[model samples]
Target: MTRAGRPTRTVLAVDGGNSKTDVALVREDGVVLAAARGGAFLPQTAGVGAAVDVIAETVRQALAPAAGAPPYADHISAYLAGADLPIEEERLRDELIARGYGGSVVVGNDTFALLRAGARDPWGVAVVCGAGINAVGVSPGGEVARFPALGRLSGDWGGGYHLGEEALWHAARAADGRGPATALADAVLACFGTATVEEAVIGLHLGGLQIARLHALVPPLLAAASAGDPVARSLVERQAEEVALLGVVAMRRVGLLGEPCEVVLGGGVLTARDPLLMSLIERRFAECAPHARLVVADVPPIVGAVLLGLDRLGAPPEAYERVRAHFSGAAGRAAGDASGEEVLTAPAG
Candidate 1:
């Protein structure tokens, strides 16, 4: 509450992804009170209730030292992975509201958070190529264009995990003489510390080595591509094509194809800024959507979640600055500082 004795408006902002979850408590004036990180929010595998439970635990940790009690915030802005369909988002929103975490709730695909985080304006396109791939677009008139993003079933590809599998596929085929020999064979073997690609494949199949480690192969795959390995370069080129295609299609769908539009790119793969992949992406966008201005997201998606909440509360520009400063400053202190548990006191009135 403010020193004037009026009730304070707060926002419970959450960004949950396949890798981790981030929660922050921010006053309507943009003062960040607390933040915490938790496990993945996998609604498909863990079920909707269990997935939200993860967020609940993290929110509890963030608010334990704060001054408020239940319904800690005026609104809950949750941008989560696995909330792909409108039905899924609705179900999650209903569940969150049922918990009475806040007076109101808004749930959206995490790609929306990525869009809000990077785009110069509220309306633009966001393409995230992290553990998985997805795209979302918002038109100036408030029209939204988004994909189902159900992986292969939804005609999506070119994420870290998928690239890893592709690298192994080509390497295994090359090792067996079924495909053209390339440097990826050796790169794959070295990535897994195995003498042969076959050993890595067998290990993955037998669960001796975790399949998640496949994501690690992406670096070597990109390196091989950068070093002029034909097979690796082809894979990277394909990934670039897909990324540009998603953005272009989204822009076309939203009637931004001929006009100038911001194409915000995020996720681990794109953020790595590999020379070859980025170059190819730029070229593809140039050819396909000439006016598309590509921008790599500089801030985490959690910031977007907070911004969305602030937008809902009709926060002022000063509020936006304060929230950005807090998270950006925390980020500068340590690479992973923002993801750790933290509680802060609001400034004196």
Candidate 2:
């Protein structure tokens, strides 16, 4: 029920990753009315049945309030992080529909959602460097392609988790004096609030420190490298090269990189202000893809999820800019409007 005496049409948008799941309900005009979030739903991390349950629970929580609220939840859309294969998509979609969302569910990988946020041409590439890394390519012919992401063993790299692990490995080696001495040894010691690498090691062994916490070392390490630290410089260069390789591989998979193409970069590392990584990535991409142009995406991943929902409703291509505009405004936006309640707000710049 609305002040206008009409039912508020609503769409549910969800973004599920290995760490957490987020769901939100938005009006057709893009105003967020309600949101909810839940735990990890990666089938590989949590069992398939468990992942399905988490997804269902998150979506239900977001829609549950709509039953009696002014806005009524109707259609449902989801962009999930590990739902890469068709079977995964089918299984999740079936479960969502069976759970009462029925017939109005749109399910896809996070890569697809990110692509929707960055490019309207449908023939562009999207590269993300988050806890993990992935790339998606959309052809003008409505065909979409993605490369197999085999975590670290694929010889492919560049992601927060991977980079964090790398930082730890470097520090461990440097501490053991088995590797070249660099500013990283001092930086790592300082990051763990310790006076020596031995203290940091003791903290790591005692479970007081986390592997992911090493991600905090990345920016300073990159800075040290930019200031001429060989070890730090090498790691940043390798990450940049690998990310660029992923973009090239994805473009080749979709058959659209040689002559003219667009590469959209998203995620934490790429979004950072470091020019070394971006510069190296550009140099690599230029050599591999020739005419490909790498650019930053205007919309974040949440907006990508919203776009996928709109696409499910058959919204025209022109809807992208409108939706982007709607969410970009402030003042009237609720406390947790843009991102769902579950999303941890990154510290402000």
Q: Give per-model CA RMSD.
A: 7.0, 6.3
Overall local distance difference test of candidate 1: 0.88
Give the per-residue lDDT digits (tens) of candidate 2, residues 117-209.
Answer: 666554688888877888888877777778666675555587877776677678778888888777878888878888887787778788877
lDDT by candidate, in order shown: 0.88, 0.71
User: In order, how many clashes per candidate?
Assistant: 0, 0
Worst 10 residues of 1 by lDDT: 340-349
Kindly report which residue pairs in candidate 2 clash with one another. none
Among all candidates shown, the one with the greatest lDDT? 1
